[model samples]
Target: MLAYIGKRLMQSVITLLVIITIVFLLLRLLPEEGYLGAAAEKMTPEQQEVYLTNLGLRDPILVQLGNFYSNLAQGDLGKSITYRTDVPVVEIIADKILYSLFFGLGAVVLALLIGVPLGILMAQMKGRWLDRLGTGYIVFVVAVPAMVYYLLIQVYVTDFFRLPMLFDEDRPISWILPLISLALGPIASYAMWMRRYMVDELNKDYIQLARAKGVRERTLMFRHVMRNAFIPMAQYLPATILFTITGSIYIESLYSIPGMGGLLVDAIQRQDNAVVQGLVLIFSSLGIIGLFLGDIVMSLVDPRIKLGRGESVR
Candidate 1:
């Protein structure tokens, strides 16, 4: 198990390195000649060189890449060229990542809170009206696009309650809409899928044995059926998490929320190659981290997933 975990760790590191290197090369290859603009053009050539130097743009490509990795190894993400304010990339990511995390996690958890038990009930009541109602909800959730749902909430719910658009000056409104937007897809998917599979699990011999032992319906559902059901759902977590992350760019854009999504969008519009590269690296890392954590948790629950040496679920 330890060996398996160690192997996965090494692979994740290599994958991250490759991604960062590709981003570096792509940024250097782009046609833009180092962030030319009204502000940049105002500087004399000497001043421009000095300005670029301060941002580490003066170094050779290889040296710059080396320095980036070296600093990154020491937990220092380089300063943004576009922000031009000597703000570290990690610091920026730290601020925005929490928002992304808030939205992604809040949505997924809420979806599961509602979707899972509903799926279970539907599965148990298969062919009944409640099952049909649950299935209808699953379909309804899938039919509506997240953007449209977000627009509806922004217009009707916000307007009706006369509530503030977002939570505060810095944070968005309890991150509720963004969370729901990210969650609905997975929630719908999980309900339809888990319902079918969990029903099958409940029909198995082990479940029947548990039921025959006078186990209450709730106990049978929570203790026996849930564990079996979770193993399958656990496999979905990595993909579900990545999907939520990718969708946030769209959600944040729709809401005008400032996050990594907005940062990336702004960087692209302004042709700020440095910030663009930095943001992509950070976002990619977030996905990888989620996958890694999911694998660790899966290992704990099942103990069959071994990814490296000297690594365990604990």
Candidate 2:
């Protein structure tokens, strides 16, 4: 198991390195306009060369790349170019990430809590009214775009409930509506997938055997069916939890939340290469780590899932 984990860790590192290389090259290859912020554009050619030299942009490409990696190793993500001169990228993210993470995690956890039980109930009551209602909800949430629902919530739900539409750090309650809105689609997805997996489990030969052996219906559903059905769902838990840090651009924008989600967009529009590159690297690393953790979690959930072997242990 340790060997398998070590192998996966190596692969993840390689993958992250590749992603960094690609992003770095792409950012560098962009038009020089990317680096020419308002202050930079005003400089004479000599002053510009000095400025670029100070930024180490005057160095050879390989040298710059080496410096970037060296600085990154020392926990320096570089200074923001257009956003705020000399402000560390990490500092900017630290201030805004918590709100987005808190809201995002609230949404994800709430979705799982409600979606799983409802899905089980729906599957157990297949072809009944409850099943229809649950299925209808999944379809509705999936069919409608998130932005449409976000707008409707911002208008109708907030107005009717007299809740704050905008996020206010002083009042924690202000986060509720955005959390619900962000969770809508994920809730539906979890419900549909959980229902599908549970239903599939219900039809298995083992389930039939348990029934034939006079096992109680409740025990059969909860113990055997649920356990097996949940293995696949568990794989997503790590990714879902980790991705909360990335935030939702649409949700944050609608609620006027200052979060990391909108930072990338603003950076790109302003051609802040450092901020853009840093954000991309952060997001990509999180995604890669999430995938790695998911695989490990999946292996733990089912002993049959050998990490580096093909055949199951039985």
Candidate 3:
């Protein structure tokens, strides 16, 4: 297990380096004006050269990359150029991350609480009205473009619930819409996967033998089917939960929430290259970390699934 963890950690670091390098090079391809900001228009040619020189932008790409890595090793993520000129990227993200964290955690908890139960019920009630209703909801959520439903909820649901259409930090009621919007997709995902896994478990040979031995249906479903089915689901929970906590870009933007998602959007619109780069790196690292943790969680949940051994129960 330790070996597996070390291997995964090393792979994650290499992947992160590759992503960072690609993003850095791509950002360089963008017009240098992105680094100079609106002030680029005001500066004389010599002044622009001087400014770029001070930023080390005039350095060779390899040298700049080396410098970036050195600073990264020390926990400096550079500074915002356009969005909040000269502000440290880390500080900018710090200001916004808490909002995303609060709403994202709320959304995930809401999703798991509602979705898991809905899925269990749907699986148990297969071929019945309840199952059909749940299936319809899953289909609707999967088939519809997210933007359409997001707007509809913002308009109609807000009207019906007498809730604010946009998020307001001080007004708890206003938080409802964004949380609901953020949770909807995850709820559908969790419900669909849980129902599928449970249904699969129900048809397995062990479940059949248990049924033949006169195990109560409820007991069999929960104790045997759900327990085994949840092992596979555990593998994905960490990644899903982590990604959700990173914030939903569209939902945050639509609800006007001041969060990491919206911050990225604003940075892009302002062409704040440093901020964008920093956020992208953070997001990439989180995704890799989530996946790494998911693997460890899966092994812990099901001891038969051995890591670094090329063997798994399923």
Candidate 4:
């Protein structure tokens, strides 16, 4: 297990370096004008040269990339180009990432708490009213665009309940609507997947064998069926948890949550290369790490599964 973990960690580092290189090269391909927004546009030619030169934009691409990695090794993510020019990119992200993380964390917890039980109930009560209800909810959430729900919540729920529409740091109640919007789709997804997998598990030979052995119904349902059925679902757990840090673009925008989503949008809109590159690097790293961690979790959850060789015990 330790060897497997060490191998995965090494692979993750290599993958991150490759991602950073790709992003750096892509950002370099953009025209010099791309980095200059309205704020930079007002500067005279000499002043602009001075600014770009100071940013090392005048350097060769290879040199710039080298410098970027060097600074990255030292924990410098560069200053924002369009936002707070004096503020480091990491500092800006640090200030806002927590709000998004909390919102995402809340949404995931809500989805798991509600979705898994709902799925188990649906599976246990197959073809009944509970199953139909769960199926309907999955369909409804899948068919509707998330934007519509966000709009509805902002327009009706806020007005009817007299709750704040926009997020306020000091006002915790403002979090409710955004959290709901974010959780809605995930809840449907988790419930539907859990139900489908559980149904499959219920029909397996082990279930029949367990029944023949006179295991209690509850034990059969949870201890046997649930544990086996959840292996596939467990693979997604780490990624879902890590995504809280990335935040939902739509929900953050709708709630004005001052999270990573909004910051990314603003950075792209203003062509803040430094901010954009920094954010992309962070996101890419998280995505890679999340997948690696998910695999580790899946292995741990099911002792039959082996990581390095991709082998499993029957």
lDDT string for model 2 (34-70, tens) is: 5658876688888877877788877899998999999
Each model's backbone clash number: 15, 0, 0, 0
The global C-alpha lDDT for each of the candidates, from Candidate 1 onward, is 0.73, 0.84, 0.89, 0.86
Cand. 1 TM to true fold: 0.79
Measured by TM-score, the strongest candidate is: 3
Worst 10 residues of 2 by lDDT: 305-314
Which of candidates 2 and 3 is the stronger one according to TM-score?
3
Candidate with better TM-score, 1 vs 2? 2
TM-score of each: 0.79, 0.93, 0.97, 0.92
Return model 2's CA RMSD, one decimal: 2.1
Compose the digit string of candidate 3's lDDT tens values, residues 1-314: 78878888999999999999999888878877777777888999999999889988889999999999999999999998889888999999999888888888899999999999999999999999999999999999999999999999999998997889888889999988888888998899889999999999989998899889999998998788999988888888888887997758888899898899999999988878788889998889888888988888988888888888765522
What is the clash tally of candidate 2?
A: 0
Show the lowest summed lDDT stretch of 10 residues, model 1: 305-314
TM-score of 4: 0.92
Model 1: per-residue Cα lDDT over 172-236, one tens digit each: 45456566667778778878888988888888998888778888988888887877778767766
Candidate 4: 10-residue stretch with minimal lDDT: 305-314
Ranking by TM-score: 3, 2, 4, 1
Error of 2 at 128 (Å): 1.9
Give me the displacement of residue 28 in model 2, in angstroms: 1.7
Off by over 4 Å in 4: 39-41
The residue-level lDDT of candidate 1 at 68 comes to 77
